[model samples]
Target: MVSNLAGGRRPRSGVEPGTQLGALEAYAAQAHGYLTAGDDELSQLAGLLRPLILESWLRGVRAGIDPMDPGSERGLRGADLARYRDAHAIAPLLPLIDKLLVQDTARTGLIVVVADQFGRVLWIHGNPEQVAVATEMGVREGDDLSERRVGANAVGLVVRTGRAVWVHGPEHFLHRMHQLTGAAAPLHDPDGRLVGVLMLAGGGRVAKPEILALVKATATAAEMDLLLTAMRAVQPAPRDPAPVADGPLGLDVLGLGQPQLSKGGERIPLSQRHAEILLLLAEHGEGLGADHLALLLDDTDLDNGTIRAAMSRLRTVVGAALIGSRPYRLRAHIATDVEALRAALDSGDVESALQLYAGPVLPRSTAPGIVDLRDELRVRLRTAVLRSGDAAVLRRWTAGADGRDDAGAWVAYRATVDRDSTLYAQIEAKIRVLDRRLGADATRMQRSRS
Candidate 1:
């Protein structure tokens, strides 16, 4: 396939006005194999082959035919006519040659062309003297003289070699085409694979140095155009995430949490009761109705009054600023709309969810049940980000979590991003600064690696 960057940088395809072929001229003939069935089919087929007939006449001088004389003809039947027709069909691609043949009667020349990708004649152009030389070798405008079509000629050779080449007359490996000269360059995809060839042919003025440059330039342009066309047909890859704070979510919980969060950062302090409520909700990310929540508490002691009060207080603290309403429910952000949270997690959109679940589920609240939920949700979110293969998002999430100062998470984040093990010791050292147990484990991990 072609790369998207090949447009506008290619050259133009036009032959020089006084251009002449030199020693590099190569006459490569492709086999013409046409099958004949019925008279009607043959006539229809010949009609389709008419353009090639005209192109043949244009390049026929080299084959000992008169271009101006309508009556002068070569009695080609099935096979020869097919080859002739195919070559002429490709001749139009040689815009210069095609225009000369159509508009200029005095211009005598021979042009070399190849199939774009399918092995058809690409073009043919020339003055009279040049045309005569081309004809002798069956170098017509629409010839399918591809390497696979014939054996070795300037056309096939350039395609076969996958590079630029020049062949003059007998230089052709095939004796059938020993009367022409050709200079050609290979066409390629963005990946640099050869796609086709551009060739110039004429027997009159042999081996002109400028012709080589012209042919190379033309081929380069054609290749670029082909590549551009190919690139337009392909789709691009997905874009990577932007920087953390500048992101839509404002924070990514892919790896570790931000170790710092102040009043300016909208940081919230967790109260014992708020923390307890959050832990419970984080534990059950699944729904828990008010009745179910009351059961978890000592409702009998206060006739459900105590339970309702706890729920009210939890709402006022957790969703207070976010929802701005009483009865907003505890663990409301994470416990409610559980489906959206799960989807976001499954789709690797945890970074977005982290910001949604920001400010703790129930700040400063703590209960046995709440602690379980909080720890569970934290672990689940952590695991999901790691699986997503985006450690940075995980780091951001961890930075905002209770483990913002946790060394294990930081080391893991760094290790995932850098793919290095040497940082394990540093991670353990940092963890030791926060928690002795983690520091010991970190040391063990580093020793294991060593």
Candidate 2:
């Protein structure tokens, strides 16, 4: 059957309730009443009116009608077009709009309309013939047909007020939308934030449950994906720094708070050289053998005998932390599964990655080789974070900054600042000082080489 929409009056601009918002409010109240009464059938019935509402909202704009005011049934007149407020003229939903393109068997020749939480249509699927009729009705993508001023229809009514609604045929205030039946439901986040709307419209009689189920299922899946992505954006890495002690250097290997350098919580102080060595090796995941560590210190004057003496003193200072088998190694048995850690990061499972990197790399002693390896890995990790350029990485690098000896933190800050000015301005005053220090260090190193 040919749609009755063609004979309906085109909207006039200055008409009161020119926009579809008023109609949307009315329908929303009705839907809410149905829900409050525990009338599931009526609630489902209300849910079927979304598509026409969306269509009307869009058409109201093109006709220069006040999008929030009900337009006149009278023919379009220049004097009538003056009431356009353009205030509540937010655009229609777009994300779920494309789904309206496909025809579903459950709702014979139905036109589907889905929108994102922001009221943008995303998918519009429907039968080709029904779509053609809808096109004649001015129901289409890139159109915001809200029922607020455009009068009663499904999408506008449900989404504007975050309620489910159904508007069938002549019940739509605008005579233009009388031939179509529409059902709409609001899409919401876990926190009950409205994210979008799912709608169906057709020329045939509405199949309440079948259409409702389809719209609900689509909304649920989209919400799940949205939540997962949002959660991953802010999760922090899981690593706790070692606590301070007066006696031996304390390093926490198990990631628990137990102190390896003290007995009964009493402090013991190690010599400055021993403390430096312990800190360096503990930061390096790979064991730094004695000889390579000696090179890192540039201590060519020290013989193997002297290095052995230092190792012995370091062991005595932190005996409890000694786990590795070799004299050159910090702890006798620090181990990790690099493959597993990397896999977790690659799979976008950052929580697992943080869990896997939980403990200190080494806990007993520090060697030059270990220090160099740690530095290299730190650089690698920073570069990886820079490449991602995500919001979290930028925040982390910002917090890592201190007055001095924060080269890694400074580098990351600089890398992200140009792209994100708010972060850049916060660290701007400190950037110059860091650059000068770094430059001087570079010059000194070059002079030493020559």
Candidate 3:
């Protein structure tokens, strides 16, 4: 007999179908009510889900996600989307994925979603009818399926735990996602680093142990394909030579407050000192000698041993081959967030630049080199935005955490925008606050002068 697996409970042998269905329905109702009421302590409630699912739900609630909202966070689009897809290391494996999973799953009333390690969906394919349903549920290309945004699901969970997961109806944290089931497995590169997640999602009928097994098998095949591709792509080259190709050694320093290196789809964390060194090396494509690097690091009193020791430690994480020691340079073509922001600004794309600027780079770092680099980037980006004279851009900049206290940006916004506009009132209020603070400062200065 076909058993209902909606509540993640397998029917016991010889249990009456009517009785089992009734129990499942009652359990789902209770769980839904408990979650809707914002009560996270599921231990007190009987007939709830497994501990893993409960924990995921609690995290979702803490992230301030609305269980009723099906919309996922959207990321890249248009030309930017195209460029990202083309540059992604997984691009070559997509066709193989479509043939092995998407084509077959579409006919089986299921959808195949391929998300990056960060939980941004790059591709969504399925039968026409099911695709429409998925879109209506806010599942689309570029949607961020990260746990912080979309709550618990196969994609987010697999990325989070680096393990295969089967989320059945009501097992999902979001109430709107209760009608669907998802089985996802994390795809790892040849080095065993997670590259992305492969997910198979369908309605209640498809949630089963066998489905999870199939997903795991498919994920394994995709990993092997990726491994083979990488192997074929690599070629021997001269030592300490400039990168032959624009590889995927992407560095993100903005907003992260610490640098994150993205290589072969894996995010490699870097120490503050390491981040400063990498940024310096990337900025100076010609390379910086050990002595030069030491000076930049504000270690003038120390010798080359200190720089060499730090570089030696960084080599283990970023690969020795990627770091050339002759003059201390990045052997790979490193892409940086700062470069992207600059490019946007250079092309008169103030809005694009603002979007690219996540925040001040390595905000807390007091290292001399880092401080100079950070301040230069922040000042340049802000100057370009203010100079744009676009009220919309100014308004967006002022609304951000960094720009909220920027009195000049607010003043520019006020002058550029229509006085009678609704946003003007908000800007004026901020201006008034700034004026009061300035007045108080002037008063204090007068007392100090006395």
Best by the TM-score measure: 3
TM-scores of the candidates are 0.30, 0.31, 0.51
**Local accuracy of candidate 3 as per-residue lDDT tens digits, 1-450:** 223335556433223212344445445556667667644333322234444555577567656788788563445556545655565657788888887888778888899988876566778888788877877666677666767567888788887677888776666767777777788889988887676888888876555667778888888998999888779977754556554543588988888666889887888988888888888898777676664465456522235688889999999988887888767888887899888987897898889989998988777665545655676677677888778888889889988987886777887888887789987898788777864654333222222222
Better of 1 and 2 by lDDT: 2
Root mean square deviation (Cα) for candidate 1: 30.1
The count of residue-pair clashes in candidate 1 stands at 78
Of candidate 1, the 10-residue stretch with the lowest lDDT total is 26-35
Q: Stretches of candidate 3 above 4 Å error?
A: 1-28, 39-47, 70-73, 237-450
- Model 2 Cα lDDT, one tens digit per residue, 354-410: 455443333232433333333333444445544565556545544542113444444
> Which numbered prediction scores highest in lDDT against the true structure?
3
Error of 1 at 137 (Å): 2.2
In candidate 3, position 121 carries an lDDT of: 75
After the best TM-score superposition of candidate 2, give how far the Cα of residue 32 lies from its true spot, in angstroms.
23
Q: lDDT tens digits, residues 92-207, model 1?
A: 33454334232342243545555443233444444656656555566654444544334445666554445565655543434556566667777666666454566676663535
Q: Summing lDDT over every window of 10 consecutive residues in candidate 3, give the lowest-scoring window.
A: 441-450
Regions of model 1 farther than 4 Å from truth: 1-108, 117-120, 127-136, 204-206, 230-450
